[model samples]
Target: MLKEFQSLRLVETDFGNDVKTNPEVVANIYSSLLAKFDHNSDGVISLEEYMTETKKMMKDIANDIGFMPIQMVLEKDSLLMKAVELHHSASAAHTIDC
Candidate 1:
């Protein structure tokens, strides 16, 4: 995953300044990802482990980057709040019926 992310041409470029890319950042990120996925710390993450971690990380990124503005809007909008409440009620009813 770190290799894949590094392969991405998403270099931070400022006009004429050479930004020093920290290899340690990639290492740290990979280490953290591996630790999160490798429950037993066996130096290998299985497919299931990878998928589980990927899903969790994606959800976290989504909540952090995508949901912040929506959450703020929800906080300000009574209509949205009512709609969310209605949806929650419907879901709860469905679950109870099930």
Candidate 2:
């Protein structure tokens, strides 16, 4: 993910893309993403947090993968769907706001 975050130039990944990779921006994103999975609010994500979040995400994606197209067409909403929308919106907004 960090590699992909570093590679963000022409396109936005989970993190925003920009013309430049400033240290502050990198740090902000690194910290924000780290905070997301760091359930204990620690500076680092524990192995348990990492594995649990990974498994949850895998289950979420696996369950929804088949219905994604239909969901998009139907505009169905859920916490995961809303979070993804907010993530993309915030990625763009954060770049501009920062």
Candidate 3:
């Protein structure tokens, strides 16, 4: 699953196109990724570990990019888009006054 995730990440992030030719680079990246998720030193990441790490990473990102208008290329049916829709609905249902 880690290998699959790394392969997908490389493809998704437009890196390591030639995994066979550049095994060193791929291995280096994979090792770094493994080091990140193996936080408990158990050499494998469980679902709880993944979620905890992901949430921390997201929180760190939000803190670093605080109050900045974020523009992401999102699909219409994506979770983020759904969050936006929900926010808009709630806004429409309420009236804010100064």
How high is the CA lDDT of each candidate model? 0.63, 0.63, 0.64
Give the C-alpha lDDT of model 1: 0.63
Each candidate's TM vs. the true structure?
0.42, 0.45, 0.53
Output the lDDT of residue 96, model 1. 100
Cα RMSD, each candidate = 9.0, 13.1, 7.0
Two-way TM-score contest, 2 vs 3, winner = 3
Candidate 3: how many backbone clashes? 0
Query: Residue-wise lDDT of candidate 3 within 1-98, one digit each (tens)?
Result: 56776656553344645434466676777777877887887878888888777766754553444356776675887644555566556656775531
The residue pairs in collision within model 3 are none
- Which parts of model 1 have CA positions greater than 4 angstroms off? 1-18, 58-98
As for TM-score, the candidate ahead, 1 or 2, is 2
How far residue 73's Cα lies from its native spot in candidate 2, in Å, is: 24
Candidate 3: segments with Cα more than 4 A from true spot:
11-21, 67-98
In candidate 1, residue 29 scores what lDDT? 68
- Candidate 2 global CA lDDT score: 0.63
Better of 1 and 3 by TM-score: 3
65: Cα error in model 2, Å: 0.7
Model 2 / residue 4 / CA error / Å: 12
Residue pairs that clash (backbone atoms under 3 angstroms), model 2: none
